[model samples]
Structure formats: structure tokens, C-alpha cells
Target chain A: MIDFAKDVRLWFAPSRLKDEGDTPDYRFSLANERTFLAWIRTALALVGGGFAVDQFLPDLRWGVRVGMAFALLAVGAACALRAVNHWVRCERAMRRHEDLPLSRFPVVLSLGVGLVAVAMVVVVLLGWTSGR
Target chain B: MSGPGTDRDAGLQPERTRLAWRRTTLASSVVAVLALRQALRGSGSSTEVAGAAVIVLIWLVFLWVAHRRIRALATGRPPGLAPRSALAVVGCTVALAVFAMAVIL
Candidate 1:
């Protein structure tokens, strides 16, 4: 595990970063920053979806309602955390002239979202049958 | 390639990044508004009022951070984002999401 004290220091201090590597091209860094922002927006949208599900779907069974909301909320939180971690890692990679780190996060995220969509369809059909 | 001003022109990368920051700032603002609406929508008790106030405060902090980054990107040769500032932005976002969950639950 990463040293918690060191992680805290890195979060609060700028001195350690200057020694990480050479500065990368401005355009690449800008692109990385934009990517981070995009992920953040994605997280926000997911969280908003969670709120919508909880607030607007009072007709939904309580178990389904809370479950879906929590699922979205949890993914949103994960995305927010990943956004910054990825940004930092990318920045470091660029500075060091190394290959950008790759992860299965995008694939997992897509699958997770697809599963949620499928769940929503089932819930909607169930609600239709019960309401009528 | 030939002239001094040509290199700095560089095809609008900074401009695009600045616009992205602006877009995110607006998006976060909408989220904060939604969270605040949720908090105060019904018979808002004192606790709800306090939560709403905190939501606004966190949103303002995010706005401030984004505004700084946006302004920085307006320059032709913008410096890299400070680590602390990046941490602040992420912290605000995570905090906002947590508060949103709290409001819901």
C-alpha cells in the first residue's frame, strides 16, 4: 500500500511534483486536464441520475428504488475518484516519457452502465404490470 | 515554423481546454443546484437548510477552482495545474456527491 502520510503530503504539497519528471508538451497536458474534467462531468451526471431515480420514482418499490440509486451513487463516486487518479498518472507518464497507464476501467464502466439500463427496463415493465 | 508568433498560435489548444473548463463548471453548478433543490424541496427543516447552505458553499469552492483554471488556460502558455488545486477540485466533487447521497438517504 502507498504510505498514507506520503499520499497526504503529495496531496497538500507541490514540491514533490517538480522532481517527478520533465514538463511535457503543453497541449498534451491540456488534453489530459480536459479528460479529467470530462470524467468529472460524467460522475456528476451519474450522481444526478441517482437523485432522479430516488426522487422521481417514488412509485418504484423501495428495494428497487434504493438499490438503483445506491448503485448509481457508488459508480459516480468511483468515477470521481478515478478521474483524478487517472489525471495524475497520465501527467506523470507524460513527464517521464513513458507509456500512458491503461486500465479496464472504461470497459467495466460501460458494462456497469449497460447493466443498469437493462435493470431499468425490467423495473419499468414490472411497474407497468403492477400499476394496471 | 518560420515566424515567432506562429509557434505560439498553436491551433487553439488552450482555447479548447478553457472551454472545457467552462463547460465543467457549468455542469457542476447544475448539480449543486439540483442538490440544493432536493434539500429544500419539501418542508425544509433547519437541518435541511443547513445542508443546503453547505451545498452552496461547496459549489462556490468548485466554481472558484474552475474559474482559476479557466483563467490560467486563457494565456497562450499556461502552466501545469498545481497538485493542490487539482486535489481541491476532486475533493469538492466527491464531497458534493457525498452530500447528495446524504440528502437522498
Candidate 2:
């Protein structure tokens, strides 16, 4: 019987990775890919969220759409940037003896996204109050 | 073990980051289209499209940077890429929030 772990090792050429990290290489790579997928999912969620915003307020105006589009676009770009950084950090930590560089990832971007979301709320309020 | 002379850019990062940025651009484009469709059908589509276009341009810059990184990686000398811009993030959030509010009310 083929050993699944051994087969995977051969397929991925795991030998390319350094052997001393606290985390396993295979697990690390998988985690990196999963992180990328999460970013993609987040991008989709923002898109959907942007779409849904219109449903709640039919009295919509141009400003809200413009703002929301920009916000969602920012969030999407951040997600992709996070994906790239995660891989870079993870790989560097595993492959190079050098210390892993500091990362700002979701830490910095998520907060920015949250604020954008708040802007979304503000826009709703402004539109409703203006009575346009 | 990574052999001697393996710089940071010696691996697949450029390709990976490029792909990541590409995905981001694609998603932004989709959202832009969605916003424009909604706005045009109603009264706010043009604004949404414009805002989204602005965001896309940002991603395009990101894409170019990623490509440069990829080439650096391919050459086996890691290049230092700047961290994500906080100002850009804040601006985008503010823009999106405003757009959403406009549409909802």
C-alpha cells in the first residue's frame, strides 16, 4: 500500500524546504494556501456585502455607491496583499535561517476594513437625513 | 536545506504574489461592475463605477509591484517590497462607506 504521507512528500518535493522549523513544512504550505483561499473568500464577501447595502435603502444616491465601491475595492486589494505576505513570511521563516520579518497583515488591514464598513453606515445615515 | 546563495527572491514568491494581486484586481472589477449596474439602473451607478475604477488603479499599481518582485525572486536575489500603505487603506474604507450610505438611503 502506498503511504499517503510519503506520496505527498514526493509530490511536493518537500526536500526543498528547510527541516528545522517548529511547524512542519507540509502543514505550513497547506496553511499558506488556505490563507490565500480565505482572502479570496473575503473578497467575495465584501462584494456581496456591497450588493446587499442597496437593498436596505432604496432611497439611494450617488455618493453611497461611490463610497461603497471604493471601500470594497480597498478591502479586496488588502486581502490579496495579505495572501502574498503570508506566503512570503511563512516561506521565509521555514526556508531561511534569518528571523522572520514583522508582519502587519490582517492586523493592519482588518482595522482599515472595519472603518470602511463604518463609513458605509455613515453614508446610510447621511442619505436618509438629507431626504434626497 | 536551502543551498548556498539562495536569496529571498530565489523561489516562487513573485509568481505567487502576482497571482494574488491579479485575483484582487479581478474581484475589484467584479464589484465595480456590480455597483455600476445597480447605480445605472437607479441613480448612483456612475459614482460607484468611478470609485471602483479608482480602486482598480490602486490594485494595478500593486500588480506592477508584484511583477517586479517576481522577477527579483526569479533572479535569486530577494528585493525589499514596501509594506502595504495604511493611508490607502483608510482612504478606500472612507470611500466605500460613503458609497454604501448613498445607496442605502
What is the DockQ score of candidate 2, to 2 decimals? 0.06
lDDT tens readout by residue for model 2, B1-105? 566786444345545654554564455455545555555564546666675566556445544554554464354443333223212332343344345445545
lDDT of 1 by residue, B65-93 (tens): 88898888766688888777777777877
Which pairs of residues clash in candidate 1, taking residues 3 or more apart in a chain or in different chains? Answer: none
Q: Assess each prediction's global lDDT (C-alpha) against the native.
A: 0.81, 0.50
Q: Report the C-alpha displacement of residue B27, candidate 2, in angstroms.
A: 10
Off by over 4 Å in 1: A1-9, A128-132, B1-7
How close is chain B to the truth by TM-score, in each candidate? Answer: 0.86, 0.51
Model 2's alpha-carbon lDDT is 0.50
Fnat per model, in the order shown: 0.65, 0.08
Interface RMSD of 2: 10.1
